[model samples]
Target: MDPLTLGSIVAIVTVGVLFSGISVAAGLLVVSGGFLIVFEGFSALSLMPEIFFGKLNNFALLSIPMFIIMGAAIASTRAGADLYEALERWLTRVPGGLVVSNLGACALFSAMSGSSPATCAAIGKMGIPEMRKRGYPDAVAAGSIAAGGTLGILIPPSVTMIVYGIATETSIGRLFLAGVVPGLMLVGLFMLWSLYSTWKSGDANVLRATTYSWRERFEILPRVIPFIAIILGVLYAMYGGIATPSETAAVGALLCLVIAMVIYKLWSPTKIWEVLRDSTKESVMILFIIGAAGVFSYMLSSLFITQSIAEWIGSLDVNRWVLMAMVNLFLLVAGFFLPPVAVILMAAPILLPIIITAGFDPIWFAVVLTINMEIGLISPPVGLNLYVINGIAPDIKLKTILVGSLPYVACMVVAIILLCLFPGLALWLPDMVMGPEL
Candidate 1:
């Protein structure tokens, strides 16, 4: 078959399989399987072990499982509740205070938890019900958690950053630092939007909840101090040249577990075992997808498809900003259908070189790409965050979550635009902290 026909077939089958409800790993595995056979005949079956291990045999990727365990440890504890209640004490006087507090909790939890869904699950269980009970609108309550949860992937220790760094061969530390400013900017934007929506609609009534005294505020601090330390310790370890990302992840996980078991008294043997098992299962699933994408990328390389597309993009005479916009647009749409990791894996090989050639800093592009990924987390039709919140509060209609998320989604778009305009937001922190990437 001609290249166009063959390419079309691969595209159709891959997307069809994914939309059919199979996991992303399964979808990529099928695609890679087909291309491997199509290109190399039956003898190619011998390469499975090499492909799988080769893709996963990276030092940096080791952080993924460690971070997963750390997040799971926190999730399996009272950290989520503590974080929310602590933030609520301070934020409860603001308009739509619960929503704002939920966003604050999600942000702090994002610092602890690198995965978006985990952030959502941990925060949603507490935030949604409390806000709903206090007379917050279903759409706003659910939407806030779903949108706020996206911060997990934008903050440091982000699993998405690890995958993106590995895929693009960027520095994971730099990627982590690059996310800090933009992540905070997005947080502010979300909070501002929350305040505006609540004030405009008079739902800011959450301020009516009993305001905490200074004593009460200080009392809640103990429950939150450990998590604060976890966030600061990991950031310092990575940014202050104390450890590699993998080492930092390992230390973070171990410390979090110690606190959970000894200090918080939240983790039992069964809970520890469950956390380990769940982390291992998730890590394996992600690794399989990574391996399959490696194979699929190789096939694209062999077919000259990626090179041809890159050359075609480079040939365009338009200004580079237009092309960057198009790339962001593509990512925004694709992220709705594909998980952030899958989108990063599939696009990195194709997009990174072009982005570099266009004179955009890879670090800035990574943050921008991540923001697009964040937007997808709360989007309609297939937003995983929406589904997660729905699972926690089954009475809240999915449509409510989806609608409520639209305002926060708009805030995220503003964030993406602001990042585009001021690449400094993404780059300055890395430059200041690490003295710029070579």
Candidate 2:
């Protein structure tokens, strides 16, 4: 079979298998091995060692576990619940008061967790019930938390951002910093949409919103201030030249432990062990996926499929803006079917070259891509966050969750466009904070 035809076949088979409910790692292994059968065959079996072990040898990857530990530690404590309460205190007067608080809690927890599903599970456990109690339409309450939780990956300390950085060889620190503005911008977009939808649907009028006095608002600060400290300290330390990304992760992990143990008073061995075990489990799964995708990416490179794909894109000679738009659109659609991290692994190798060749800022594009993945988490059928919210929100239909989150998807799309139009929105903070990229 011709190379193009052969590549197409393998790609389709892998995607089809994914939709058929196979693990991504397993699907990629089968696809990569299948690609070799058509070309390199048994001779390339030797590449297995390099594929699995070599991909994970870097010091940078250590941050995955540290960050995971940090997230798990915070989740194990009352941080998520405290964050929601604190936000609720402050945002009660907003149009979609409870909904806005839900988003706010997700955003704050996103700083600690850097994971969408974790954020969803943690915040939605509290946010959804509170919103429902406040007379929020079940769909809006469910959707607000479901969609808001995606902020975990778009905000700093994000595991997926680290993956993208490693995949693209961009600086993880810069990428983390780049996401700051875009992440906040997305929070605003989501809150604005929540306001609009709540007002439009007239749900805002009936919902209960407690107007908090300044003294009452001050009472909740202690519960949430420690979290803000951890986030700022870790990011600023990394970006202000006090720590490397790995070191920042370590500091964040340590702070998270302190918060969980001393602050939250969960000094028991069982709780500590559980948090570590959970962290280890998540770390192993993500790292294994990374290693697996590495092998698959290597196979694509060895076959020169990535080169061929890049050349083909270049040959189209489309305007760069047009290509960027097409890429974002493709990512948006791809989010419907593929999880964001998997899409990044496959597309980064194949498309990053084309994007870099066009002289677009990769870090900027990284934020853009992360936001696309954010939308995917809430999107349908396979949206991990949707299931997460559903699990937490009993009696809430998946259909309602999906329908309610559709407006937030528009927020993400708008974020992508604004980032594209003003790459500075993503780049400026990283540039100012970290200076010129090395």
Candidate 3:
């Protein structure tokens, strides 16, 4: 069989197996892409040794596990609960204050953890109960957590950005820097949307309105300061050239561990073991996907699919903005069906070349892509965040979560448009911190 035909078969089968609820890693290695690569008239076993072994040896990939460990450590310690309490106290005086604070806390936690489910699990556990007790509707509570969880990718120390940087050979630290403004923008938009919803629905009184003395407000700072310190310290070290991205991640992990031990005092031996075990499991799952994706990507490249697709896109006479909008539309539709990680692994390689050819900055594209993926997490049917939040609060209908997420999704669309119209919103920090590319 022709290599193109074999490649197409592998791609289809792999995607089918995944969509059929089988493990993509297992599908890639055992039944689809890898198997095809091995048997497709190359030296059978030896020709694709690099696919089997070399791809998994990426040193930068080590950061995935370390970051996961760091996130799990902080999560298991319930540090996020404390952060939420502090934020609630500070924001409770405002309309829809609890929901806004939930968004804020999720964004902050996202900066440290870089995993959406972790953000949801950590914040949902506390945020849901608090909102519930405060008389917020289940849909509102679930929707807020689900939407806020999407911040995990847009914020810094994001695992998604790390994967993007590694895939595209872009600097992870620069990508991290690039995400800061846009991430905050998304948080602000979510907060505003929350406020608007509260106003329209007359739900402003759900949270107990309490005014704190300046001194009392200051006291809550002690609980929040550690998170701020960790975020600032990691960014400062990376921006100041004191540490590499991987090293910064390691330091962040260690700092989180120490904070859990000393300040939170929730780190027991059994708890530590649980964190390690869970992190390892999640890390292994991600790494396996990464390795398999590398293999599948190699197969696609070998078949000239990426090049052909890029050339086809380049030949189009459409306006660049139109083409770009089409790409966003495609991703938004795809997000409804595909997991964010899987979408990134498959689509980034294809779309990235077209983006570069159109003279778009890869860093800006990364942020845009991140936001689009976030949209997918709230889109119906397979929205991961909705399911996660629903798991935490099962009584809420999925339709309710879906409907509640629509306004936030509009906010994301607006954010994407703003970044598109002003690429500097995403690129400025990276260029300033990383220096303009020579």
lDDT of each: 0.87, 0.85, 0.82
Model 2 bad stretches (over 4 Å): 201-207
Error at 421, model 1, angstroms: 0.9
TM-score of each: 0.96, 0.96, 0.93
Residue runs of model 3 more than 4 Å from their true location after superposition:
1-11, 30-39, 42-45, 211-216
lDDT of 2 at 296: 90
Each prediction's number of clashing residue pairs: 0, 0, 0
Work out candidate 3's RMSD over C-alphas: 2.3
> Which stretches in model 1 have alpha-carbon errors above 4 Å?
1-5
Looking at model 1, the pairs that clash are: none
Q: For residues 1-438, write the lDDT of model 3, one tens digit per residue.
A: 565465567657666776787786666555534465455554543545577567667778878888887888778866788778788878978889999999999998888788898899889999998888888887788888899999998798888998888778888888998999999999999999888878777754584676777787777687668867987898899889898778888888888888888877865789878888999998888778777777767666666666766777899999999999999988887788777776787778888889988889888999998899999998876889998888888887889888878888999999999999899999888888888977
353 in model 1: Cα distance from truth in Å? 0.9
| Model 2 agreement with the true structure over 357-398: per-residue lDDT tens digits | 888888888988888888888887579889998899769999
Residue pairs in candidate 2 whose N, alpha carbon or C atoms collide under 3 angstroms: none
lDDT of 2: 0.85
TM-score, candidate number 3 = 0.93
lDDT of 2 at 348: 84
